[model samples]
Target: MSTVLQLVKRFREVLLDGVWIANTNFKDQLKDVTWKQAVIKAGSLNTIALLTFHIDYYIAGLIRVFEGGDLEIRDRYSFDLPPVESQEQWESLVNKLMSDAERFAVLLEQMPDTKMNEPFVAEKYGTYLRNIDGMIEHWYYHLGQITLIKKLLSSDLI
Candidate 1:
């Protein structure tokens, strides 16, 4: 398999389907989560909805760059999720995340193996491979949090 294809597989594994790392992907974790459950505050941890939005923020921003646009995302604004008050709203966010994730994978798969070593947007941001790997790691970190938060929300202790 090509390096780019391998990256796409890993990307999809975290966001959409393969479960080699967490035993759960974003699609599976967020599938049955209701708006209320997603917004439930489990201590100081971020809500599942917020984490979903946060990850999608980066994905969407990267998509723009992948499509030949500027990298306009900022860390401070990543968590600025509007609100998830209804099932429709929550589902919309999830749908967007899923679509963006697939789009990201598709864009990535189109890249040449040599492109992986090229700087992402700027030299400061490191190579395409680094950013992609960081994204996967970032998603897994939040995936663990979402999993724990779900467990806490389900337990009577929370």
Candidate 2:
């Protein structure tokens, strides 16, 4: 495979690995927390629900654009946020995020190497290398935040 494909694959791996790590110490192991706990105010950053939503939201948005749909990345959900409120909802979200990631992985794999270096213009970030590298970087960054938040929540629990 080409270098670009390799990089894209590697980034996808990183994201999936990070997701696994985030769930490793999860109080309920992805099933334990109530909606209230998921949305509990951990810090200045958004609650786990918002963060989780953001991850899947972005992935879905980007994939849509890549597939020739027009989407605005900036306009995310607004307000007090929806209550996961139940174990079933939380688990559903987790499954959805993983499914989205898998779809993204497949999209990246199918994308041509030339597309990686092409410019993708976004309303907020402007033009960037519309490629897997940028997406991978974004994924890991948020994954790090998710991991940290999990730790913070754990400490709070104990």
After aligning candidate 2 to the native by TM-score, how far in Å is the CA of 27 from where it should be? 14
Q: On a 0 to 100 scale, what is the lDDT of residue 96 in model 2?
A: 83
Best by TM-score: 1
Write candidate 1's Cα lDDT for 33-139 as tens digits: 99999999888899999999999999999999999999999999999999778999999999999999999999999999999999998999999999998889989
Which candidate tops lDDT? 1
- Each model's TM-score, in the order given? 0.98, 0.73
Model 1 clash count equals: 0
Tens-place lDDT digits, model 2, residues 1-158: 88556765565565554334334422233345556667777758777777777777777887888788887566445223467777778878878877787787787777676665556755455433444566666656766666677678879542
Give the Cα error of residue 143 in candidate 2, in Å: 1.5
Error of 2 at 16 (Å): 1.6
Worst 10 residues of 1 by lDDT: 149-158
